[model samples]
Target: MTGYTCTSCGEHHEELPFAYSAPAPAFWQDAPTDVLEPERCVISGEHYFLRGRLVLPVRDADQDFEWGVWVSVSKDNFFRAEELWDDPKRTDEPPYFGWLATELPGYEPGTLNLKTNLHTRPPGERPLIEVEPTGHPLAVEQRDGITLIRVQAVAELLRHP
Candidate 1:
């Protein structure tokens, strides 16, 4: 397997799984409500913007934490999400998807374990994830006014724990 030394973490990795593919957190269901109002960017009263730190699974031993993430939801998808936000019986809906809006300073795209089908927008257009219509225990949280998602907690949520 090919490997590269991470300049940010100084660790040798056989593969970079920076791209994360997991189920959207349930709390994302009510993005219109759950999303902090101040940080929210609403368009035409039907679309809203969701942006925050998306904690990656990559750990930095020196820093004792995982890498940083910043993702944003697309406008059209956000509108669709709003329509289904309060539907109690909308259980069969497909997962909400978002683009990979930004890139880490030193990482290359297509190397991370992110879902391939998802479209990545320009630097200003952040990546998107399907927001579950419910709350996932480990999905969303507030820290210093930033919405953060911990990779560890995400793993646990994926395992249906």
Candidate 2:
């Protein structure tokens, strides 16, 4: 596949990045030092967060676009996830309600605080986040899927933003 020129950096990349990720929740930046953990699971006082993926189908491609993002869940749900962290049966757990904690770039009105359902996968995979049906651009893309050209556009937008 041909790579596109980055609008921001004006550099040519060899391939488009099908996946983007936020290392931690947006709140993590302002979290107090004492309430942090050295793992993917974060418990900032009463708020709980877990890293997961929000996937969108690529209409004309064989692969899907994925965002490695964070979701804030309740304390009880957080503990339940931790308890099944390594269990293959973890996928049996029902979806957990959460709020999107990552501010995904390139979306109007921002992407934080969107309602989501975190569905547990098997032991080795991150939970799959299903954005609630809405008219937001991100949600629309998730529901209707996007073309490869759109993927390229997103790659360009995020490359140096």
Give me the candidate number with maximum TM-score. 2
Model 1: residues >4 Å from true position, as ranges? 1-40, 43-48, 51-74, 88-91, 109-161
- Stretches off by above 4 angstroms in model 2 are 6-11, 30-39
- Report lDDT (CA) for all predictions: 0.36, 0.86
Candidate 1, 27-137: lDDT as tens digits = 235444344342244444543454433432223322222333323456766665446545643344454455333333323332122321222333433333322222322
Q: Per model, state how many residue pairs clash.
A: 15, 0
Candidate 2's error at 38, in angstroms?
7.8
TM-score of each: 0.29, 0.89
Q: Model 2, range 4-58, lDDT digits (tens) per residue?
A: 7776788888898899988778887554542544335565467889888899999
Show the lowest summed lDDT stretch of 10 residues, model 2: 31-40
